[model samples]
Target: MILSIKNKTLAAITLLSVISVSVFADDNQLTAQEKADGWQLLFDGTDMSQWRSFKQPTVNEKWQIEDGAITLTAGGGGDLISKKTYKNFELTLDWKIAEAGNSGILILADEKGKYIYSHAPEIQILDNERHPDNKLDTHLSGSLYDLIASPIASHKKAGQWNSTKIRLENSALTVWQNDVQTAKVTIGSDEWNSLIAKSKFASWPDFAAAKEGHLGLQDHGDKVWFKNIKIKELN
Candidate 1:
């Protein structure tokens, strides 16, 4: 069912994201040939060359690279984001809690200090059974942060890596957990727009209106590890 909704949502936002992407292009960097070739690694498993902390009014003191993975350390704050702002792209990464009582998030469609969930929707990563942050509508691992909830239960043991795939085409968003689509969402729909209008993004410029933006990894600071990050730039 989740996969079905994801496909349908992609169909709905295909036109919107494409049109918006063209409008938002900083440069015509990716040619048709590039899209035809194959996938690209956003994170080569050994470097932090492609990501940085979220700008202004935020901090990520807990992020570190260990054993080829981005791991969370003590006192980490805020989120880490891609240096390359994207209009549309497919992203893959893996994450897991270090303990049975922790949580984190994988964010997309971001535009700076606006409400975290309102501007940058996140895929929740948590130990559902024991995490201190566990909650139904918005706190479960694999959720769309606060916008959409995961229909299935995912409680990968603490300290065990779990995978996630996220694809965002302008307003269209899809998420997969352990190779299964877990949540699908379309922004700018009447329903999505309504939610946007009532949230912090309503008064924030380019909050959720962006065509291209960064991919963010949130640090909720309870010990999480991330690796195998990659992406295939889309046209």
Candidate 2:
């Protein structure tokens, strides 16, 4: 068949768009390049074997795989932690909260503490517009809970998925929510110490002190769904 230049250009653009979408369309699965780059999938939509209840040998029954997402159902499930520990890495995940629900992603979590929040600093997750935690900017979704407020409130509404990416390399922490830079801080620095002193973690001397620890997902007795949980270690 014969085609004009404009028609040929339009066909080429459409072909490229289709190829681009096909390359990155799947959830809970990594592209070839991602696998080559050392990305690990925590939950690949098949099982939660990579995780367990905090201080427990197995995951709670209530934390189930629902529609390929790790769902916290009802209460008493306890916090979920990664079986393997990491030091400095980049973690990314997608989460959705129930109406007025509250949850958090914990980094540097360890079993030595009575509670997960004791040793880990959290990236806040909540239905920002309705949750009571919204009363304080530091507690809003995407914040470094109680320490650094998310510079931009970029969370989607409740029942909708929100993408969060957290990077902690040499204790220089950075967070992004839905592709927008939300928070940044240097952990254990003078500024971080000062912020913690005025926050509720003031009494917890070991807050986020671990050199290496497991990742955690807070139960918070609320319904929250998480998926596409992945991580990549950094040198």
Candidate 3:
């Protein structure tokens, strides 16, 4: 009787362990409800079939899949661009940076440009507490890089995941960080040009010139991880 009881307890513990692992294995997948809502996984956390190096024919090997996240090895990969261009859409992703790391998400990225930054407007990603770039409001996490500052500083510490959402529709752009709305702006308006004139991108004629282009992830020579990358197109 004692042996049977011990065996039953061991089996229950083993079953619970398997259940927990199964839950974690589904972290980067979209549920049936998400598919019905028009959501699509951009990363899927296992491969880069949806992305490629900017202007290159292949996905850069430096961007690797590890533990269900797309991780960038410092100084190993060039910027990555989505294979499909989006004119208006909603993007959601989770990112974690190493101490003092830096990166960005570029929207409307013109693939033919010499560099992604020269043509796309960026959603800044940095270690706000440790990166020197954090000193400037427009360069901090969740900002419309160098153009608009996040009204609320809501970045998590380095090594912790930060949830971000960017929505663009009919020329209006909104950014959310950690579930909090952080910035809103209208593209191509007088106010938009005014802000651009004050930023480092002022001299780049190609900057923000396109209404439709690929999305890009920066290769800023810092270790960064991105997961749960998904998007939905808007009419």
Candidate 4:
């Protein structure tokens, strides 16, 4: 077909647009890698159906859904807990700490948010220089709570977003901040056994056994926000 230069240009642009959208369509969907591994979105920017308060059963307190993300509207009173319990999985989430200094916990194997089962440990969040726990464990922002503080310092400025990841296997646990490995521990291993023998949890049943459990975000009475929280179960 004979076409004017303007028409030719328009057609070319249209074709390019089509190609771009086609690429986007494929890219927008879950990638083959993600699909093959079967990862699901726990929060998609507008709901908290997948989460609840550790202290509340049917009602979610202070945890708000906004901008396609899950966030803590206010800190304190209670913590956010994953609606679905998990075991032997990898977890990833984004978080930010607000002013006034607060803390949160990535706790696992919690029984109704009471305490960490043998399988549950915490990746504590705090304002290193300004928070009390920071003194207890200067690795503060990314520490394995009291059990094992962050191997190194890692705390972003308040109000800035930070990414965190945790992996829990049959007996091994690893934690990452941004992209650096900050903590690693093996449950029931010699180290764990040694600690358990003298620690408070030593008497608890299933203290280090691989089992089903929930993910908990501790309430430290300050403003702490979280988003992009997801978990992938490992066979």
Candidate 5:
């Protein structure tokens, strides 16, 4: 049957609305452009199937999905690591920590030492304004945890979500927190070696030794939430 003019206009409007929603997809869903660039979601907010407890085959009970975020409710959950490992890549995520809480995003993490941090370089996650860790610049949010300090403070306050972007390509590493450039370094370079020589990692012989490994989220005995975790592997 032929449609009336008014019906045709309404149908066109509905089609436009659908297209708009598709263009501006919600969190945890990749847009078409991202998918084309090889971006993959690690946590789409529904489950933790993409991650497991560090060095283990499963996730722990304390890490739960709440309000579409992977939240660490209490102690004993251990660190969570991605099922797949990556080398050169770009990773983005949103996180929020409780008051005085602490956590971290571990890169090139492997089970070569007694603890995950012993082998992995970390981008720290902390409530900078309230945590005791705030006393040191290297311990603040977005820092290369004790090895390098974030040039500026850009993290949102506790309970507020902060966006983080990390890219490691061709031995060069860069990080952005909330759109502000936080850290930049070239792995295994003279500068990087000097930084590690003075930091706590100097005692850990295998720190940052892996060229490819799993992405990790630290437990840190505190409550923290993460979402919109996505990564794009590079050549």
Candidate 6:
């Protein structure tokens, strides 16, 4: 009886190990627990049906779903925006950049604006070690572009996937890179306005004026890959 019990216990452990591996291998998929928590997959590792081009009618051809990621190579497609606008939410995604690549994730971006950067705030993404933009703290990876610098530099090297999370609730914005909190800022506040005044967006009339708008992925003429994009609305 003891021998039989030992064999059964081993089998159960092996089964659990397999299950864990399977769950981790699947990219851009929401698990049962995530679904129950109201998490939504923005990119399902298959298509760009949930996204469209800024000011354009359709998703640009330069943005392609390749190797289970929304990839942009030889960039010229312009920025990509979510079809639905979000007010307050938590977003998570994985991104990898080519050598010296430059890109960014924009929040509260206006689709009708002349440029996403002019109307929204950006979470800078760059090859921190290789890109010249890294010279300034505000332009480094995971920084709140030109407004606030990341408290810590936690970006993985080029060609390696890095996890990023952005949370916006009650006008407070927080950014995380590789599970580390990189920046925190409050929107539409006096401090925010002061930062904007000092930045290049000082003359942009609609800069950071939208309380709710589409999320955007910048196309800076460099190769970049994004995947496992997901979001959960916050009350």
Best by lDDT: 2
Error of 2 at 29 (Å): 0.3
Residue 191 displacement (Å), model 6: 2.2
Order of candidates by lDDT, top first?
A: 2, 5, 6, 3, 4, 1
What tens digits encode model 3's per-residue C-alpha lDDT throughout 103-194?
99989998677888888999989988888888899898889998878765576788999999999998899999898787888998999989
Per-residue lDDT for 163 in model 1? 81
How much lDDT does candidate 1 score?
0.66
Q: What ranges in model 1 sit over 4 Å off?
A: 1-36, 56-62, 100-103, 106-118, 153-155, 194-207
What is candidate 5's lDDT per residue for 1-235, written digit by digit as tens?
A: 3568889999999999988876765789898878887989998889899999987899999999999999999988999999999999999999999999999999998876778887899999998888888988999999989977776658678999999999999879999999989889999999999998999888888788888988999999999999999999999
Please give the lDDT score at residue 174 for candidate 4.
89
Relative to the unseen true structure, what is the Cα RMSD of model 5?
Answer: 3.2
Q: Write model 6 residue lDDT over 93-155, tens digit each, in one string.
A: 999999999999999988566687878899999988898888888898888999888766576
Question: Per-prediction TM-score, please?
Answer: 0.71, 0.92, 0.87, 0.76, 0.91, 0.92
Whole-model Cα lDDT per candidate?
A: 0.66, 0.91, 0.88, 0.67, 0.90, 0.89
The reply for model 4, stretches above 4 Å from the true place, is: 1-32, 112-119, 196-210
User: What is candidate 4's lDDT per residue for 1-235, written digit by digit as tens?
Assistant: 5568889999999999887764432311333455567666666666667777664674355666555445567655476668887778888778878765666555555653254333456677766667665666633778765566665546677778788988888868888887878878787689877766765556666654545677777666676777777667898
Clashes of each: 5, 0, 0, 4, 0, 0
RMSD of each: 13.4, 2.4, 4.4, 4.8, 3.2, 2.1
- The deviation in Å at residue 113 for candidate 6 is 2.5
The list of candidate 2 runs beyond 4 A from truth reads: 2-18
With a 3 Å backbone cut-off (N, CA, C), the pairs that clash in candidate 6 are none
**Model 2 lDDT tens row, 1-235:** 3568889999999999888765784889887777888999999998999999999999999999899999998888999999999999999999999999999999989999899988899999998888887989999999989988886558688999999999999999999999989888898889989999999999987888887899999999999999999899999
Worst 10 residues of 5 by lDDT: 147-156
